[model samples]
Target: MAVYTQVSAEALAAFLSRYDVGDLVSAKGIAEGVENSNYLVDTTRDRFILTLYEKRVAAGDLPFFMALLDHLAGKGLPVPPAVKDRDDREIQQLEGRPACLIRFLPGVSLSQPTPAQALAAGCALGGVHAAVADFEPTRANSMGIAQWRPLLERCGRDMDAIRTGLFDRVAAALDAVERDWPRDLPVGAIHADLFPDNVLMLGDEVTGLIDFYFACTDIRAYDVAVMHTSWTFNARGLNPSAGVGAALLDGYDRSFGLSAAERAALPVLARGACIRFLLSRAWDWLNTPADALVMRKDPLAYLARLDWYVANERAFA
Candidate 1:
């Protein structure tokens, strides 16, 4: 969540009048994520999240996100669905950007998760894949492999500005991943970006899975790969935990069994995941507005992850 667009108090009050959520008690902009503009909104009745779609979030994709959340919530998953207004509209214009009021879920996002938490998160992710098996709506992975090269090209030589020789390393990794990318893996709707922050946890139990903005139809194992990269490593992309990684895989296997092909392709899938984040972070590092309320993540973190994945592919395989 980020705050690129500032919503005025009068404008916010007028917008809330359309809903039955009650008078606004307080609203604060969230400045953690690099995606949409988010506000922690509290009304007389309850707390909620106000998200304004920005950056890579397309307006046409809002319905897909809302429907996916609704479907997950209906399946007993702890996903926050978009709250509809008095006119039953979930998507509306706020500050000239497509916005939605999300039901506030109670939990804290873990920065340094333990093995047990990783297990629960993995199980929850597997359950999501299972629940979405019959979800008919299809939205392509906008940040998929096909878009990586162009994103990197957009970053261009500036990649090395973050770190010496970063550009070439990423480019070589991208080439290898694209050339040897897997085919015919199990495909389904996936959260796509299951970083630890996206998961809301109470102790070891996953109370909520927030931020489905990057959710899409993609290789099921790719989601696992994304989680593997995100959950098993420290924020600096150092100090990988074998215990956490093992627990995560075990939990997912128990919840939703992985086929042999999926298991065999994990190493490559993991490298692809690394490349995806590396390029996106590189782009964001160079281009994100100087005055944006969001923190500019270091692209080198993913580069470090990419290096680790390349060296440790055999272990994953």
Candidate 2:
């Protein structure tokens, strides 16, 4: 949802000509997220999201994402699929990048979600897991456990620039996570990045689960752990919301129950989640161009969550 590349009005209109979506009325760049160039496009017919893949999103993986979205939509999940053109093509070339025109889903992404909303999001996530149980396509989690240390190394000494002693803390956390990460757990297609902004809600119901760019085949419980860390924490990552966390897990369990082993692994899986984001953010913080139209997130936020998980391991137990 960032604009690394600018698309001119003329070029955009020309791109729209390939589709049956009607004449473009207006297109505005979206600057919230750190991946892909996104535009809120409106036409005579309706609105659609125009996304130009950028950064970590590989062009080779586009089909997997498209298939996953279509699969989820087919199973009644509130996921937006890429809109095909006159030639029935879902993927297209726009602004010298592989792009897609997605159906714009209704609902605002909540900044401060209530417990009820949290519960609904949990249920929606559980439903996604259930829906994808038989999904054959698999994409490896690029940011999974194995990539943590290498990502940190890529960050190098610049890590301490974000915070003193950040490097050692993240390195040590990585060691512990690598040692304790579970070998065998239920695996399936997971929305690896289930941050609150990724889930669209109308009232207490989840209207959409957007952003399948980071979706991959990974531990089912790891997805829960990622959601737990993202949803249960404040924006600043300073405080935990117990009621929201409890309700989220309860809702998920009610919809798609977790095995006893998965429950036992949550604490460790949570630590891995923390490390994953911590390193990626650190890398993005150091490397993302200053002029990019996206907010650079703080790596220390996840470091704080890592500390919380280390001290309160029993919270997940």
Candidate 3:
């Protein structure tokens, strides 16, 4: 959720004219994520989210994302429902960009999640996997292992500017992960990105899982690994000291049992998760425009996570 594309009141009003969501009262740009242009739209009827798909997100993949949300919402998952227009189209064009209005989910995202939140997030993630088990749309993870090497090459020696030997460390981690990447694990629709900010909570209950933009078909345990790295670790992305790593995994196991292979591959999957974010943050740190509405996250945070994962692989057991 960012504001790469600015929406004028008149333009937004004209856009909303196509929908029965009522006249737009106010719309404000949300400045959290780096992918799409998001605006909180309030109307006489109800509140909603308006997202203008940015270049980072492929236009062709929009249907899969919209349909996935529709499917999950139908299953009673706490996710936003994709609001369709009068023509019954889930997506529309605004300012020459593909856009959609999603029902505004209730609750706020946690910055530093509590152990209880972690436990609930674990259960919620398992439910997400189960809910989407039969979803037929398949979108390959654009940020998965296959893209790591190319992402590294694009970063090239500039990563050394962030820290000495940073490029080599990331390259080696990529090599190790790709070489030993799991081949035969439970695969299905995984959220792929379950960061703290993506999970919304009101009190102890997780009200919604927003941002299905990174959702894809992949190893289910890899989703657990992503959640563990994001939720259990400290803000600095080091020291999985929340003591919720095991508890989170335990929570997931109660819903969908983790296989021996998934357990054994946890370490590498986690390391790959670290690399995925590190490279992304590094690239955004260097390339994202200074005036962009999105925040530039520190690449070093994921670097710390990578180090911790390497040293504490045994702890995941």
Candidate 4:
């Protein structure tokens, strides 16, 4: 939002020139995310998303992420097919950063989406899980147990005091989670951050999904967890989103029915997803350099969701 991945017109032009589409008529920033500088490039041929990768996404993993999109697209899942260069490499260096261009998905992000659309997003995400199940691409999760555990370890010695009255059970949650969290239900690639903002809606239907940076091999239920966080939680931190969750779950069930184990783990996976984002936001806030244009997302947002989890811990059907 703050030009975190700044790209000048000259640089953008050069990036576009390498592709089949020629003559960038106009390039303007498209705002539906806090990370990555995304621009809608109107070319003489067609429109496309020109993304200048940011620090949050490491370039090394771009291949697997891009391939996953290709994989899903082949499966008839609603996803943007990553355009390849003449050399067939999914990623190329540009503007001193690893960059990519994807065909612009035709849809807009909805704020007051209908119940049908919410369910559609959920089901579509589930479709992704089904499509990519046993998907053997590459790229391990950048934020998995190994990464998450140490962050929790550092949070020991009263790091909870840093945020103050925030996420009191975070430590305990992590401990019990490591010991008891469902690990064997089903594991595969997940859109680990499938927030509403990351998905596009077209007339009460999910038309396209964006942001594969967080995609990786993990528990399938965690994907459901991330969706619940987005569609079911609000900024003030309330769980009035259950109806949305029901529609989502319904849609997901229609696509690929969850196992009994996955259903049982959904609430806990949702809680883990909540805390994962919560800790990431807090860490990013605390670690961001002073001059960075990237304004860290409010850690309070996730903390509120955590509270919502505690209040409705066993409320899900």
What are the C-alpha RMSDs, in order, of all predicted structures?
Answer: 0.8, 0.8, 1.1, 2.5
TM-score for each model? 0.99, 0.99, 0.97, 0.90
- Candidate 1 per-residue C-alpha lDDT over 1-317 given as tens digits, one digit per residue, 9 for 90 to 100: 89999999899999999999899899999999899999999889999999999958999999999999999999999999999999999999999999999999988998888999988988998899889988999999999999999998888888888888888888888899999899899899999999999999888899999999989999999999999999988888988999899889888998998888998999999999999998888888888998899987777788778789888877564
Superposed model 3: Cα runs more than 4 Å off: none
The local distance difference test score of each candidate is: 0.91, 0.91, 0.88, 0.75
Comparing 2 and 4 by lDDT, which wins?
2
Q: What tens-digit string does per-residue lDDT give for candidate 3 at 1-317?
A: 78888989999999999989898899999998888899999999999999999987888998899889989989999999778888999888999899988888889998777777788888899888888878998989998889989999999999999999999989988888899899888889888999989988998899999998888888899999999888887778766654678778877887667788888999999999999999988998878888889877889999998888888778666
Residue 106 in candidate 1, Cα distance off native in Å: 0.7
Put down candidate 2 lDDT per residue, 124-188, tens digits, no spaces. Answer: 99999999988999999988988888888888888899998889888888889899999999899
**Candidate 1 Cα misplacement greater than 4 A, ranges:** none
- Cα lDDT of model 2 overall? 0.91
Q: Could you tell which candidate, 2 or 3, scores higher by TM-score?
A: 2
Candidate number with the higher TM-score (3 or 4): 3
